[model samples]
Target: MSDRRMSNAITRPRRGMALEVVLLMLVMFSVIVLAGLSAVTTISRTSNADYHGARATYAAEGGADDVMSQLDAAMQDGIISGEDLANIQSPVVSGYRMTQATRTTGVPVSRTITSGPFSGLYSLNQPIDIEVTARDTSGNRATAVLSVNAQTIPLFQFGVFYEGDLEIHPGATMNFAGWVHTNGNLYLSSDDVRFQSNLTTPDSVFWQRKDSNNRLYGVHINNAAGTAVALRFDSRSLSDPLFKTRSQQDFDGRLMSRAHGVKPLKLPLPSNTPAVTLVEPRVAGDNSMVQDVKMAWKADWHITLDASVFTAYTAADSNTMKANFCTFLTQERSAGLALPSAAMCARIFKPRLDAFYEGREDNRVGSTLAIIRPDLIDIHLDTLRLWSDSAPAARAPRIIYINVINDNVADTRRDFVAVRLRQGAQLPRSRVAADTGGLTIATARPVYVLGNFNTIVWRPAAIIADAITFLSQPPNPNMDARTSWPSATRCTGSSAGWCDVNQQAADMNTARSTNVNAAILAGHSATPNDFMRVGGSQPYGGGLENFPRFLENWSGATHHYTGSLVSMFTSRYALGLWGSGVGGQYYSPPTRQWSFDVNFRFPERLPPGTPSVGTVLQTAFRPLY
Candidate 1:
């Protein structure tokens, strides 16, 4: 109105136009604010997801460590009894609750103990599976799983039977409530076990004794001055007449008669058996006194044993108290009888084939030594040490069956020195070279024949022990080999030939030319050029990709290879268990350690009316206007 004089300049602004401009500016400002908010929200959500994932992974790892500790305890204390497992079912730590479960595959428990009762390589096989699941109140959870295999000693099956020099190591102990026989010198170090022959007592079951406090303990052997060489025991219960009240010398006479095919003179016993004594009856002024052994099985039981004094049991006189005692112990135990005295147990294991009982010919090796009944696969080196150290301890070739636990031999590999041979074979040099011979593992009972002169020699179908040992050392990694990857140099040190990886993709051609490729392809499988994953047997990781570091070929090419990339995290050997296919051909970031597991379901199609939690969908892109 003030400029009402037709001033075209101040037209007072059109009302509708002003309103439209205001709205447009407001819309632009709103769009900018919304975009900023979305970016911030995305970043926050991503960070939270990463944090939770990390936490879950750590929790799972903690669970694994706990399970390992439990296993260690069981091993140190012998077999893991049912009671031990019960403890695992509900383990509590700090404020978290842990639950555990077990599952077994392959063979059952009973067959293992009964497989080859009379075979030297008979195996009492049993495998155990352990799974631990942990959860906290804060909606956090973790799981860990493990498996262990144990082979029990058949010491209970066939009483003690030995032929050579029996050396009970300083810490060794033998607890038997059955008859024992030996034809060799029995040397006892520290006292830790007891030998009894009385099935009448529930404590008759074989029990090893330990003398925590220094106590005078040991077996009282009554043998000739220097003619003993083996130890034997009765497998049957202690009540057999042969094991009753015979004197140590009388037992020795019976053993000689049995080994030479001569009839044993029956000895009379007192109508009223006096309180049986554990010491070998001593003849006044005789040089051959019973050698004393300390007891390791600290049981408060009373049964009597008459032992010889001389450390050796090799007296030549046919009627010498020492000789009679040694022979008696040997023959009676083999026949499930007893040597009333140490003399009868001496010289029981003569090499004469005619001296062996029928069907027991296979049981008897060279001299008077008879194989322990209940064929057992020689698994633990320590068990071998115990028996081999005993009288007539012949480490005859026997099939040793074992389940493959881990592949990479190096994981649990240690140089085993001093390998004693059994009757018919020659002993190898003391030291068993690493990565040289194949390590046998038994899956099923001693079903398949492994070796004849030896017990068994079955090889696994998928993974072979030979392969595991062979690959233990660095394979021919093409050190001089050149590769094309992001930014990297050639490998340094003994592990050369492959490229020194530094965030890059290596060419497949370089991989095919290296020794690593040669070794892998040697396995008779398609070769993936980009990576080298390696792990196969027990004690070692599994699969190809599970290997610590490897090369991967993302690009689809016929024959391409990549440089070496170390995981800096996993076991020495790479494992390819995860991912698709038998050999993990696909590659991903290296795993620093054992981590959380991700579950996948079958049938790619989703159920009707269900929203996908974390999945990708393909659709046309559209702009919102």
Candidate 2:
């Protein structure tokens, strides 16, 4: 019995030991669970912070875009003045707030990097730097920087800007300075020609004819007088090292130190149909009936001619003279007034015309006239007196716009208006003029500048025409007019002595240099078929080399000229043919001394009809963190 009691006591002690071991394991498990929970909580908080930072970065980008948009809008609206940088606030987006500040400066002038198609440093205003700061609700922040440039493009800044192909294949030595750009391909050929300025184009530059089996002609650099034949390029490759190199050892294909390709430059027109616009004028017409008056509203002066006078002259005139005289005018009378005939409508509504002219004064002398058609209007600079030294601004006409036909007419021919300067007429003078504002003459029709226009004064002037032609001195100096007119049977045909003396002046002095100073915007002959060909066999339009169409022989003479030549459309009439030697068929080539007018560089000296070219370019961008 004693041994059994001792065994029971040992068993009870063993049970107590087991319970203590269990309690220790429970405490360790609780410690491990609590540590795991703490780690998970920390990770959740870090993830939220990172997500907020990313959101802040996106907000900053949006803020920068908003700031730039506002700045562009302000500039376009003319709200931003010079030296007027200001702070701007951006609208809150998705609980993010943004603030912006702008600063502008003039671009530093660089002589070496003078001008180019894509270079904005020549603009009057320099770069605009914008700073944008974006903040989140949790105080996380991000920032962005952007740079913008606004430019006012002057058309005359370029020596030549053509919407179509530019062909510089001069037979004689030619020197051109200033920026040159073309939307179409550039064709450079000739024996001795120098381009002293930057040249650019969206299309390829060809040293040879792409259609003529790649025929290469040579070109020179910076030799205006053609005395030296330095720096010549005959390579037809655009990737040729010569195109990018400026060293004298290597051919300078670009002529200038810096030359590169650029995106297409867009120039907006005032109208889509007419493609041009000028100062306001009065007109009365419909599809069938149209009446146009020239300077009729002006109180200064008036000139008129009667249809009866023309008919009487036609009765005793040659068939050719009668047909040319009444080309646009009708012989029939309507409601006691001369009405434009159906033939006139058909001719005017045609796509184009060979030429059109209207005399400033009434050549008939005694006949009173009253009818004017939209297709034909007289450009009487002598009578209208566009130039005057003492004329008041109100008295003088600044912009002259002629609408050849009413806008209602859908026919392209109805849109045609021909402005022919009186043969051998001289443009009015601007000598000692108080008002220095320039003059702009714009027309939708082809314009023929008879002879010696704007030669007396170096006044600021521009001509915007569909096609421009310069008729040489008449074949017969004794003829009454450069244009054909009805011959008079009797010596004293009319009381006004209109037929007594031929209006055509004696041929211009071939020895004396002919000076033409103005900005000329005309059309180009696209296909060979569109070229102005001679009327007879062996037709040969002078090509783009003779862009200024001529009719008289100009052999052994020099033509001195200074102006900007711009072609923006296809030529409506091809250039006339030419032949070699003195008194040859058509006209002879003259020594061309053409130079860009430096006065055009200044905004104040720009012509009245200059078009504004605007572009907003992003110069730089950055992210701040």
Best prediction by lDDT: 2
Q: Compared with the true structure, what per-residue lDDT tens digits does model 2 show for residues 1-625?
A: 6988999988999999898888877888888888788777777778887888888878877877887776655444222444335545564677877787777766522222134444622344456778878887789988888887655465666677776667676777777765677766666667766776656675666564422433334565443332334433432343445555532334333432223434444443211323122212334431110111122222122112222322233233344434454343322211232223444433222221212221211111223431111233335354334323235333344445543323223433222345655322333333236645666666555666544556555567777766665643332333223234222211222221122122222122122235566777776554342121222232223335566654333466556667777776665432222332122333445677777777787666767656533334566788886
Evaluated at residue 607, the lDDT of candidate 1 is 14
lDDT of each: 0.26, 0.49
Please name the candidate that would achieve the greatest TM-score relative to the true structure: 2
Off by over 4 Å in 2: 1-142, 223-261, 269-380, 386-390, 406-417, 422-433, 473-513, 528-544, 573-586, 620-625
lDDT by residue for model 1 over 1-625, one digit each (tens)? Answer: 5566566544546766798899999999999899989989999988876665456545555655565466445433223445555665445556566666744345634222322112222233446665666566665665655555544322212123222222222222333322232222222322433433311111111111111112234533333343332323321223334433232343333222122221111001111221111111222432211111001011111112222211123442224533333332211122222222332223221111111011111112223333211111112222232332342213211122122112223321111111111111111111122311211221211111101111122111111111111101111332121121111122234331222221122121122211111001001111222111232222212222222223332222112111111110121111122232223232322212221111001111111111110000111121111
Query: Candidate 1, which ten residues in sequence have the lowest lDDT sum?
Result: 608-617
